[model samples]
Target: MKKNKAHSALLNRYQKLINISCDLASELDLNILLSKIVRAACEVSDAEEASILMYDPNKKTLYFQAATNLDSQLKRGLVVPLDGSIAGWIVNHQKPIIVDNPQKDKRHFDYIGKITSIECKSLLGIPLMSKGNVIGVLEVINKRGGGFNKEDQDVLLALGAQATVAIENSRLFLQSDLIGEFVHQIRTPLSALNAAAHLLKSNRVHEDQKKKMIDILEAEIEALAEMSSSFLDLARLESGRKQYNVKEFDIRDLLIVCHEIIINEAHKLNLLFILDLPDTLPLIRGDRKQLKQAFINLLNNAVKYNKIGGEIILKAIAEKDRIIITISDTGLGIPEDERSKIFEKFYRVKSHRDHVPGTGLGLSVVKQIIHGHGGEIDFTSEVDVGTTFTITLPNEI
Candidate 1:
């Protein structure tokens, strides 16, 4: 009877492991998945709290990326030592450790308790390993029951393995997507350059045709250069490599500046560019340079696609704690069928492609910058009528 019961217990534990592994594999968002992994660790190990510290290979330090009991401020970029701590030891040795009496252990980092405000009497740490290399550490603190046992250790290790694989897959998927987008974006400009060059090489070309071909080559080269720069900038923004230089500034000034820059172009198109902003508008907080780029892109689009004699309005309104800016253009509006795809990377409206020259990345970059500021953007448009883009930015960062 004892042997039969032990076999059933083993089968049940394996079943739970299978279910959790599947869950981890299915989660794709890095932040959400990391939080889930820590939460799952607490659940499977029967611990009071859990945290995940990802290893920074360059810095050789582990930073608190996710936790169950810690606040966002404490978890963000909070670093733990990789020299004398229990987690550090796990990484160095690539093993799972259970400290029933953490006070007695010399490897415990006491400052961690002070930093996170979570008392630690015990800890169970497992190395998040991938391909024989220790990537990070998973730690569960203060078991709820008497003490952590072999079962808890086994379950945590299983969870760690599944999390490691999922994390790698998520990162690689992002890199692959960026590469694919870069390729797709550069193809058109490159083809244009190639065809222009081939035409210039033909001896049958007249003087005027030769000048036109050379102009095409020069224009395409500049376009290609600008596209490459924008791609790298957007990539850095998305990858968290480029930090935002956040500042509080007057929203009216930005609108006025954008109008001044695009007004000439609008005039060339026979369009009226107007800016209507309240003098006492609330001060908005964001990266001023980045926001200016976003504004320029929006206003430029308003003019680029506007019909002759049409009007472009840059208007701003303030709510209780938000500033709503609307860029409305009496331009060639987007079709209902293409509206859903306009924001996608390298996606331009099919009908407008031949008429308008664009790389299709402007709106996407604008969306990214807005979202990074903890704001939202929405738009509404009608075919042949107009399109209005409304951006809501909070007074607070």
Candidate 2:
């Protein structure tokens, strides 16, 4: 009878492991995948809480990436020394460990418990390995059964085994996507450059036409360089690698700076620039530089696709708990069919491909920034009428 019960327990664990594998396989978003992995680790190990610490090989440090208790911001940035912590030990040794008395264990890092205000009685940590390299550590703490046992360790290690592959696949997917986009975008500028060179090489070219060819060469080259830079920025932002310097500041000041940055370009196109804002709008909070980039892209697109003598309006106002900022332009509006894809990386409206000089990454970057700040962005447009982007941001207390 005891032997049968043992076999039954093993079968149940096998089923749960299979279920976890299926869940991880279907998830592609890196952040969501990591969060789910942590939760699954907790479930499989029957632990109260779980977290993942991503190792920085270059820095020789381990930093908390995700956890069960997110309200503890302190843990988010908390770094564990590669030489000191239990997670670090698992990472260094590339193995799994179960410590029933972490308080007495010299290898354990106690500061994490302090940061989250959760007492740690025991822990089971395993190395997240991919291609024989230790990328991170998976740790489940405070097992509800009082102490982590061999079964708990086995379950977490199994989860860790799958987590590493999922993380690598997600990263590879991101890189493959960005690389494909860059390759496709580079072809446009290269074609222009070739055409410009061919025209300038004409034996009977007049000075006027030669000058025009040179101008095209310069503009196309500049566009290519800008595209490369924007691609890097978008890659960093999307990968959760970019650190946001979040703070509270006046939204109007940011809008003013955005206006100053792009107003000259708008005026050069014989377009009217209007700023609509009350003098006493409430302050909003976010990364100043990132938010600035978001506005710059919106206003830049407004001018790039606008009619020759069009008008651009930037307006900001406050609601009860949220702030709304609208950027409207009398420009060539996006097609109804393509509007949904406007925020996709490297997606440019087919109609505007030739007329617009862009990397098609601006709107996607803007969307990433807004979503990063726990805000929402939306738009409305028609073919020839115009397009307006509405951004809703929460007011920070």
Candidate 3:
């Protein structure tokens, strides 16, 4: 009779835990869902602290994403080694572990204590698995009443499973939004192609008119091709399907190459081309080809939008732990309100619509490439004064 009563109580606790998890999964907001997961884990398991560590497979690092007791922002992006850590062990084994004494455990990482300034006594960790692969680890530390037991481990594993599904759902929602925008961007080129075909087929068209229609068809085709390529690149980067090939390269030499490549176009427009690079600019670690593409996009825009006989300047300098490269053009600048949307996919300034010709994907692609290298790109512009694009990359190479 006594054993039966104990089993009944355990069943009731399990049912309540499942109900809480169901509520958590219903949340569509990612930040709120993460917070609820950790909070529910701590509440159900009676732990002093709980944390979620998300894994970045590209970087091969585990970063703390959220926590219950610690300052949420402070714990975020704190990387832990993939070897000889308690969380790493759970990730590798794909199992739940209940540690009564974390300090006595060989796999316990001491660096965490240095950051949080708290001595961890007990820990319970489980792998956050999706589709049979470990995406991260969910852990609760310092059990409140006594120490973590089998019941706590079981509850944490259940919570980890629910959290994984919710995270995947949120990511899918975001991707669908981006895909919809990309689809809409292709319609303009398609309409132009249709119009060109109609004009070319007209029987009354003269030879000169026929030639002009052919040029329009060719231009539309080229624009479609360029837009398609940019769309693919952006999708790959945003979906985490592409990995950067990082290497050390000289920034000075890269600028020189860009200057030489665009010199002819500058001359055609009667624009003065200036290259202001230091003799000892630091080496930057990134994909050389992608960086070149980013620079070319900026230079192309400068030439396309500049007034005749204006000047375009490319400058590079070394800052602390980073190399800053700026490309400035005395061209038509973007309006203040439209500046924020310039880096968005298929977003172009309204003022430049009639004056410049582009697919509006150049800056978006450039931003994605720079972000893939763990860098940042920003710009400042004043109408009719000039626009400047500034890129900053780590000098870790």
Highest-scoring model, lDDT:
2
User: The CA-based lDDT of model 3 is what?
Assistant: 0.81
> By TM-score, highest first, what's the ranking?
2, 1, 3
In model 2, the Cα lDDT at residue 79 comes to: 63
Residue-pair clashes per prediction, in order, are 0, 0, 0
Candidate 1 least-lDDT 10 residues: 70-79
Off by over 4 Å in 3: 1-156, 202-204, 371-374
| 10 residues in a row with least lDDT, candidate 3 | 70-79
The segments of candidate 2 whose C-alpha lies over 4 angstroms from its true place after superposition are 1-11, 53-127, 131-134, 145-151, 198-207, 248-250, 278-285, 319-321, 395-397
TM-score, predicted candidate 3 vs. hidden true structure: 0.68
Evaluated at residue 75, the lDDT of candidate 1 is 36
Question: What TM-score, to 2 decimals, does candidate 1 have?
Answer: 0.70
| Tens-digit lDDT track of model 1 for 1-397 | 9999978876776787788889889887766788888888887777999988777666577766678886532233445677878988998888899998886788888865774677898899999998888778999999996788888898888888899999887767767889898997788788888877777777778888898888878877887887787787777555433445566798788888888899999999899888888878988777789989999989988988899999999999999999999999998899998899888877888888888877788898888778766678999999889999999887855
lDDT of 1 at 375: 75
What lDDT does each candidate get?
0.81, 0.84, 0.81
Residue-wise lDDT of candidate 2 within 22-137, one digit each (tens)? 99988889888988998899888888999988876776778777788653222343467777789989988988988888889887777767645788888889888878888889
Residue 228, candidate 2: C-alpha displacement in angstroms: 1.3
Give a tens-digit lDDT track for model 3, residues 133-196.
Answer: 8888899998887989898888778777888898888668757876798778877778888877
